[model samples]
Target: MSPTPEAVDLSQQRALADWLPGRLAAEQPAILVLGDVMLDGWWSGSIERLCREAPAPVVDVQNRESVPGGAANTAMNLAALGARVSVAGIIGTDDAGMDLRNQLVAAGIDVTYLLDHPDMVTTTKIRISSGGQVMLRIDDSARSVPAEALAELAASVRSAVEHQHAVMVCDYGTGVLADPVRRGLVDALAGRDRAEPGVRPLLVVDSHDPRPWAPLRPDLVTPNAQETARMLDLRLPEGQERVAEVSRHADALLEATGAGAVVVTLDRDGTVLLRPDGVTHRTWARPAAEKQASGAGDTFVAALTLARSAGLPLTASLDLAQAAADVVVHQPGTSVCSTAQLSRYLKAFADTALEAGELERQLELHRAQDQRIVLTNGCFDVLHSGHTRYLNQAKQLGDILVVALNSDESVRRLKGAGRPINAVADRAAVVAALSCVDYVTVFDTPTAAPLIRQLRPEVYAKGGDYTPEMLAETPAVEEYGGRVAILDYVADRSTTAVVNKIRDGEGAVQTN
Candidate 1:
């Protein structure tokens, strides 16, 4: 067997972050979710003391909330991430079923395929929490899907998956994904793929049991460690060997199931995605001291499917999915990650640093929205009022301000040794955090001419009382119909003067 490959070190997060907004704006990809749908109810109250009857604490219920769970939860996540999602599954003709449908509809999911069964009871997991801690979980579920109901659901699944960009099989072992229904879904997807060739919708499976799904030949299957181990009939690996062990087990899963890829989620350790070509991509989990890992897996698979449907590569999709899971695990209850939350989350990680290509991708999207770009360059070694005012002026010139800083080597060559008080990463972060600056990137050149050539901004901005004739990038700026704006210099604010003053003990150099 081939050794597990290292995770793809591509800037997938940055790429996905740059790609998402435009994809979301251009089109809302449709996804069909099939399997067991459930309602998750939360009852919360304050627990003051132990109950007088049993050992359990007495809880006075003050608030009651219900949300979609199981396959429905997956659909909710896809919808929350801006996918045009539709749900196809069996639900009881009860209050929980009605509530589940309402919640799905409220989240902008199509419930046309959500069939109601008179004999079945809507699956529900009611969690009671006291003082922010879950005290008890009461599960109300029906294990059997009537044959007629299953046939109806299979028909619904077939029709729903036809027009969707992707299909998600979210099986919780709830009998909704029984053998017959699974085979029907598989046949339906196969027919569609055969009919459309390269245009067929991608199929992703996240099942409690991986065996039944294996024959479906899903494009991707997300299995937790135990599920993957169970499918392979192997024990979970322990300690330092976990990564390698999981990779090996994922290999077995792929061979056994014939899945195009297998994503083994190793709880807090992170996730490993194994492709058929013997490539394994790993992503480390985002850190959190306290975790609410209840709905993290659903969040992950949903984002993964959505990103893949949006045409991002598997690496970018995995990055976006991992980031989405990280966001959900830090929140309470079985919650879905919203698009705004995801956008903010990606921004937090990508803001500190970005490559020029990623920045250009972002710029393209911004321009698509008619947002004019403003480009500026500087060492920004030690931020001061001069830099702040300069960046502020640049921001006024366009809808977005992009600051491209020189690399350490470039800075050293231009300003001599020991000139940049802060490293490039640190400087980029500092500039990125400023309110006036919209994006930050680093260029390994003595001048920003190359970056200017790539960006071709509507306005090229400069500060510190420099005339256009003195700037070498003037022709490059004018080449793209970009006008140069030179802002007034802030008196007594030069970094050199500040360093000289501090060197001579005239005063302390203030950093802004």
Candidate 2:
């Protein structure tokens, strides 16, 4: 009957969509991230005329801004997703570094581990764009970080791990994720004894090289198709057997690195997650019509951590994480995916199913709503009332409330592993379900400006702790006549304080 349904594609989908919204509403999940963090800068306008001095087309230079890229972007994605995020990484004592710290602090991430390294130039990526698509990118930074800086950063990460729910390493081949720091970070999260489930600190990594990571044996690892191929030293699965090849590669990765699971990202196709059970599940991309794919991966990992922390099964987590990815890929440039966006995507899919290109049409309709959206985002690793009271009140001041979620890499760039208490999808679901939320999105940048411009919200909101003049969002939000609104926050109601209190034995630490 009906071809036996082929595969159970979306039961857990509904559950995941509802999960994060519930978590955000309830206020829970703490995520710790350790790794590289970089500043992503961009200049976008139009090629209205050609440069007189050169053959290159001259852009009108309509806009210029910066956001966290690489691991920092991943942390930002996690924070946007509603995770109680804590970041640990090395930053140069420079303007860019200061900017990065302010971005994290404004988004609700714990920046105690975000260290200051003198003389090190903050890693930054400058992209020149035409319209919304990227044309070229330039990297500015040093390759090897000073040893002393690495040690200090690692120490801060170690301290955070003793109190976090999970550990994620975002390696961008940058100096912050130094070899020694990587090893020590792994050691900190490694299972103490065989009977203890390889330590309560679930180890997750997203790195370029496999050799450095093999010894640590992470709990989860995500690499793009190219990275997977390089890691395995072979051409990955292609054609009909792609799934099998990925599954084999995932198992091989697990065996090689001692990780618990492997999630290989396939561009144009989708993401395939290989379980330790040797099962391979494929989640196809459900991108919105005429959208861009920027910070989609960061959002995926951030939501994934939140989901797992929420006690969701792997399949459910994968389903929801993929759903969150679909939402982010549609936004312009590196952006954040908030719970509202996730919820809208879910509700749209649940109502008409993700078939017949209904989602694309739905997204267009929402954009046409003409609301001055107030966008503020973070990785609510663990949902908490503090976040709720703040978000709920902020939503009341805007026509549509949008949250930008940090990807797992963004989480790591800011927080050392041990974070996004909930998986990405679970976090997205928690925010989506909230009545105050209007749309949710994900970004890989440390700052929400890129996404803010893309959405062009009428208003920007933040916690009472910071004024609009001090906000990194002021420039972007004000450019569009959108005013920045600051909501009053409860004193000491924070993810960092909660995590510290737990470490101090405030109550029982329950993972599930």
Which candidate's TM-score is highest?
1
lDDT of 2 by residue, 22-76 (tens): 5542444677878878888877878888888988777776888888777778788
TM-score of 2: 0.64
Show where candidate 1 strays beyond 4 Å.
Answer: 1-22, 291-293, 350-512
TM-score of 1: 0.68
Models 1 onward score TM values of 0.68, 0.64
Residue-level lDDT of model 1, residues 1-512, one tens digit each, is 11111111112223334445445534578999988899998899998888878887898999998888889889888888888998888899999999988888888888999999899899999999877788889999886778889888776666777878888988888798887788788778878878888877888988887767777778888888888778777787674357688776655788776789888888676677787776556555664666434788899899899878876667546756877888898888789898888767655634466788888999999999998999999888765556665675677677778888888888889889767766776667556644456788888876888889998899999997799989999999988788988887777788767555545656544432
Please state the error at residue 429 of candidate 2 in Å. 14
Provide the lowest-lDDT 10-residue window in model 2: 1-10
